[model samples]
Target: MASIRISCLLMGLLTVFLGTEVHSYAASFGSLAHTASATATTTTRSVTTTTRVVRKRTWATQSSNKAFNINMLDMCHRYGYNVDGQFVVPEFMKLLNALNRAQCHMASEILYPRDYCLSIKDEDKVDLIVIGSGTAGSLLAAKLSDNRDLKVLLLEAGNLPLMTSEIPGLWADSIGTEMDWKYFAVADETFGQSLDGKKVNVIRGKCLGGTTAMNNMLYDRGLEKDYLYLESIGLTKWGWKYALKLYKKSEDCKFEKITTSKTVKNFHSQGGKVSVDSFRNTRTLGIRQSFSKAISSSNLKTVDYFDVKNHRGFVSSIAMIKNGLRLNAARAFLTDANRKYNLRVALKSTAKRLLFEDNKVVGVEFENSIGELIKVRVTEGVVLSAGPIGSPQLLLQSGIGPKSLLNSLAIPEVAVNERVGSNLQAHASFLGMIVSFETQPLKAYSISEMVYEYLLKQSGPLANIGLSSFTGFIDVNEDGTPDVQIHFYYYSEDDTVFMPSQLDAFNFNDNITEQIIDINENNDMEIVGISLLHPTNSGNVIIEKTDNGYKPVIKYGSLHEDDVTTLLKAIEWFKKVLTSEAFEKYGPKIVPLKIAGGPEPNVDSEEYWKYAIKHLTTMNVQMAGTCSIALNPSEGVVNQNLKVFGVENLWVADSSVIPRIFSTESSAPTLFVAEKANDIIKNQLGCKGSNESNEDDDENENN
Candidate 1:
């Protein structure tokens, strides 16, 4: 009887959860959902409408929702819903289930609510197969598909992003959701000591837009020198001038300051797919202004991050957002019309391995949504855009890594590229350095009120991340290039409950988080992160085949002395900002974050900061260089053309091909690669399709 009750409870919970999800999507996509009253009125005999018209309308109204309802009922029945089954809390469950059913039923009537893309039939062949519709693949597939003559297939391991992802502030909510790949770095004793399980959560977006859908919407193109290293390494096309051109091509610069600036007028572009604009929330403008003043007071000029002449300064960030919605890579590139013919997307399809005919990649084998293994042939080639982690993991799984590892695993070696998963690099940032202010920087509002405000005006905290959008770059060593990037997030006094601790955004331990909450309850706090752009140490990714599938073993975070020294200098730089007249007015002071196994050290001492630096550093998730671009096979997995060595028609166009980690967010660079790859692939395919499209062009879009 107890077992039956437990089973019934779980079944009811599942129904409620799934039902709630459907309603939430409906609320987010208000324009899509149909009204039940309208449906009922249409069904009834209305004097205003003709009988024939009513019948036609009713027939046309039935959609995927009908199938969803049937499937939902079957799922409930299979989970132990029966007339004869004795269950506890029957009345409550029955009431809740009734409400949920009604809500879900209404939600089902919505048209193309989820990511509705063209499905791939078994054994189908395409001109090109772009694996992983991530940051790069999404754009690459769309660009390649523009020919309308060549069939392009884009495979995504995860489904479409939820409507909540459109809100910039809700980015953290998707970290562990179905949208996230949920890759965790191997636990390290040297760092992540205060986090849960001593492990750092490496967030990689699994959905159509890839990490672009789930990450903070900052749109930063690194310094010009960042790509000079690539040019110096024989990748001449990837020089600063060409890289900036590609960035401009992909960007629809909406910021008036950038679009109208005479000095930077040529640096930005219009009519691009990705919309770059300031955060929509007006409430944060005051705080950002204060920060800009504070930065000036610290003797650092406030310059445009996009200006070619500038290398170090504080500036209000521009993000991949327009109005109030996130313009992720998929949304920017893969439009519904694109799927009408040449372009097709297969969601929830995980590419297992590459199928090679001799030395050429001919096709791919992947697991479908229903756990069925299927093979799809490609006429042209395969582009591996599965990101730094996924790309390396797939390569190793296909026996393209070191021969010794493949031999031990008993997998046949496809190639002997020892560098397939080596040279992994990322920006390291310490998260524990914090500052408390005497007054609240910004007022905290309730979720319901914020939602209402956003729905009505499209302006609120939900539309932006407040002062967090203010980012800084510093040339710590006085070199021409910036070595450190500063990112700070503000927590309003009243935000103690609904903050990082509750969301587990950083995976901090309960004790450490609670300490933060205690401090934040009365005083507004700023968590300043100093990112080390250039690190001497590097790590690698290895894959092990499991009964389920291949699991990525990420051996990362061995910080070098140089990295630590740079971070120390950054700490001093930030301290000057705190002491500035603009910030000094707030009576700001450093408050070291509490760590486990501690009597806290003196907050002002260098020793205390060193300890904090050692324990608090975390990856910025701008990971790259696992399958670096080099001159030959011994040095890297891919060459300057991004083609894998010893293999024909197998290209990599993601961060995996980045020769070096740069001092900025990875999104823009990844997109630049996609733009470059589009041209390369077009040149290789001998297609004459143009890459440029107007913003209002209706031929293809992701919406």
Candidate 2:
């Protein structure tokens, strides 16, 4: 009884740390005799008494000892909890290992009351089929299934998200993990040639929540002008007003600053699916504030980026985080939907091709986890929300692309639409700039200490990227329009874990990685990531059938001269920031990395900056434009309603429909698109309470 009580107490604590998933199991063990004694001790040392209780009340149970053991093992491996015996005790380690070897299901029974997936028969038919349980698909499927009469099937290529994905700061660590699709850009001499193997990695989350599960959770709605450009380019109804309505409908803004700010109060809304909040407590708060101060000192206005009136300014970012955990699309939208009998989620199921009959998509063929092909027919329609890369690749697999390209691949052309895989645009940035500070403003904690703080209080350096939250949108062209988005990353001395992911994400060469590691080892460093909001060049995605499956071959355009100039201007803007009064006290200075086998140009010269920018250019993975939206079939793949031109009951709802690249991250915009798609889908299905857009509603509204 004593041993069971002790083990159960540990499991309870694990529940508290692991977020809402297994939180109920922890509460269930609150009745144990030993829990009271351990609770005070753990709470006093790691978490505030109030925070622990509040989290307990907010979360419910769903887990087992096996789940606990595995997740604990994951935590140990992921965050260096067992590194150098930092936080490990010999007896406690033995208990964990024993639990790992034991079979336990009762905790899981309580934690997860029911399985989310519903097994479907091979020839089964549903009212609607939604491919890809990504940011868009998750919400779209959830909303579609809300009508009890309609049956919705959501197929995901990957399984459910892991417990580690809940931690906000660990988002980067998942770049090359199992949860990521791990798509690498095909080698190009003219693009990303300086990087390792002349390749740049494209990150797409393979799990249920999709990229939202593995991404930096910054919720940027993009500039109002970006939407106007969409409207001008034939996406007539996707203007600022319609877009904002969808944005507010999907967002549940929890950011006190934004909610309270009179300037942007009306811009945000309450009680929506996606919870948006500010990083309320961060270890490097001082550094973030100092950088914001530096922006003001540089003569740039510091205002809420959410406010469209002052859209271009410096401010700490608002993220899709709730209660210190990552609230991904699945968590926010699909969790409750799991209980709905009308929705069936097929996890680890890859959609092979769309089954088309006379220009109508009637069904879909997918490969299940055990390598079996299953065909499911759709009665109402099929929506492809498989992201820009996946959706276009799938379309090409089903022979809906350029005829010449399809013929080259020996694929039977189902629908010849020349624009199926063209117009790929992504936000590229220069990661070579390193800013050094003489003294560190925040005290660095050991891995064990940081882990404890994260597990207990859910507040610390591990809780959020400190200086990274503070970003600036600067007007590089001096036209009063922001041209670049500046992202800042602070690395404390001797950080062994963080740099690997950063290097791997950009696929930086060994020489550059070594230089960065060396600089980080000696000095408190800030990596200046200057991202071009709009680029002159565009790329395309093509499919190459492999023994395993279809692989997307991204043909990114060569770097344009205008794009390079924009980055150069951004670097100049950053120079002003470093020299500002706020940074003077910290003695901030630029530390340039040597290019591998390049001309020895003066570091201060334009030629050197241009060379560096070219060598270091990489992407933010805000990929879009494939399967673009247009007024007609001659112009693009999809129409204003996001319906595929040549097919009936077929639509594309992901970032692939964005006709042009925008000035911010794509997640929030993707959610907005999904919200609009949901209403459109619901209205088509004759579902009650559908908030379909009215073109006349925005007629009297100001632009």
Candidate 3:
């Protein structure tokens, strides 16, 4: 019905333009012409004649000053609303109106404009209520609401995705914006010196798509062992054999270039919501080729890392980008079709606490957009997908955590689960590797050219996120499993000197910003870093009661001795790649490692490397295992079913339930968990939803 309205509006505008006289219109409109051929129909008896014209137009001038004209042209192309023949005043006005509406739809979000949930009465109740419109929440909400009979409510703390956030390359621009939660991890005393001995910023998307809308867009399903470890720990349903199916169910791999590997072909899926693809531009291709060659020359084979069976190799990084825009989880799952009926989404709604009747969750108390406290009842169940940090905090605030912690905060304990915030894990990283190259004038046009290219064609350097093209998963134990993950970042000659505003989403500190500027002043640079995929050391997420509300106290680091040794090996492997013959021509140089209260370390010394490991270790931002899934209440807050150990009808479907940090970025794995949890919840609820019509349900049931 919405599509019909758009088509009718477009057609009404096109008809008005085609009805005008050609010569006079072209003269007044400043060289506007239509290319489509016109056909005349005549009736013999009445001598009535009609002319049907198809409209088309081309740019008469090549000036960049034509903002209005360029934008209109871009909108027409983007929406496939072709204007074929002769332009007129009415048609022009209609085109302007259409463009304005599209722009407003992309730029603005419905916050408190009109409260959709306000109409619900005290007696009214939904079948399912999902908190947090993030990665897991969005997908689960969409799937659960597919059944027309089911009433599903989804709540988001932030508003919709902005037009700026939709741009793939402008990811960093949203870092400190209203879209991000902007939480910080407490500075690690041992390995957090590189962050200027200050708290490391942890960015989480507050909007509908969650972190999927803000992350680096790297699409990776961690090693098979990561999930197998979960199965070994009592989560028998989470092994790779079962988890891979969920991954395939959510992914729609529509890459331009496919790898020539049977395993990769079998692994990747098509016709799903999320788009998975590799960088295909010339610049990105060159970087990928060079990085792969370097890794290969260093005694590592180049293979498609997406293949779970053979993941140890260098390959071009895959991303959740489609047509140069971020295909976030919200866009992927919560489509217009899905939201048409049976689904109510509330934006800018923050959950204050969970409502419990004895041991079971009955509803949730939340603050609406205008700060009005509203309680929504749930008939079936409540799923808390409020991300790793928010999930545990909500649980603690609702008196579902440690008894001692609840008593300290003067909150009445509902359930004393000591492991609510323990078992926190994140990939430990060191971003000290910097390879400089001779400056080259790569582009013929100015920076404006790049911007225009992105605006008009959605191509050029701005198309890609500019993080890197290649990545490698390497084994440290000489076994088949990989313990270290490497990411290769490339910077153009201009990018190093004056950093682009688009990269602000990273929220780098002043020191790192200055370092980047200093390194790129005269030459282009490549920054490569390795992360310990399976760190034995873990951390905790504690809730410290504050004057306003509860703030998370994130205590994490590479503190384990095995973690240090593994990182040392990862650093050695990276150094080997840098010293390879393929990278020799680029004049690879390691940037001096700087620590807060120490001098620059000697690059070749083992003691210096260890110092770097201790002082320079950073969080990869792939946090998980806060509310780990385990059989014992002492070991985990959630059980194998992703439900809280002591709470009934309360489930956590986010990254917090992952028992361990995976060997790859947590985005894909997080998505996979969401997909799998949807089924788990549906089965537990015994509701035959519309998702059963899909092949995924059948495959999952069989598994």
Best model number under TM-score:
2
- Local distance difference test, candidate 3: 0.68
Off by over 4 Å in 3: 1-124, 256-263, 337-339, 439-445, 496-512, 593-596, 689-703
Q: After superposition, which runs of candidate 2 have C-alpha atoms over 4 Å from their true positions?
A: 1-118, 695-703
lDDT of 3 by residue, 440-479 (tens): 3233223333443554456776577664546778887676
Q: Rate residue 205 of model 2 by lDDT.
A: 88
Rate residue 166 of model 1 by lDDT: 61
Candidate 1, poorest ten consecutive residues by summed lDDT: 51-60
Top model number, lDDT:
2
- The lDDT for every candidate, in the order shown, is 0.71, 0.74, 0.68
* lDDT accuracy of residue 99 in candidate 3: 48
| Model 1 alpha-carbon drift over 4 Å, by segment | 1-119, 496-498, 501-503, 690-703
Name the better of 1 and 3 by lDDT. 1
Least accurate 10 contiguous residues by lDDT in model 3: 53-62
Q: Which lDDT value does model 2 have at 337? A: 69
Candidate 1 per-residue C-alpha lDDT over 610-698 given as tens digits, one digit per residue, 9 for 90 to 100: 77876878778789899998898888998766899988999999988897987788998898888888877787788886542212323
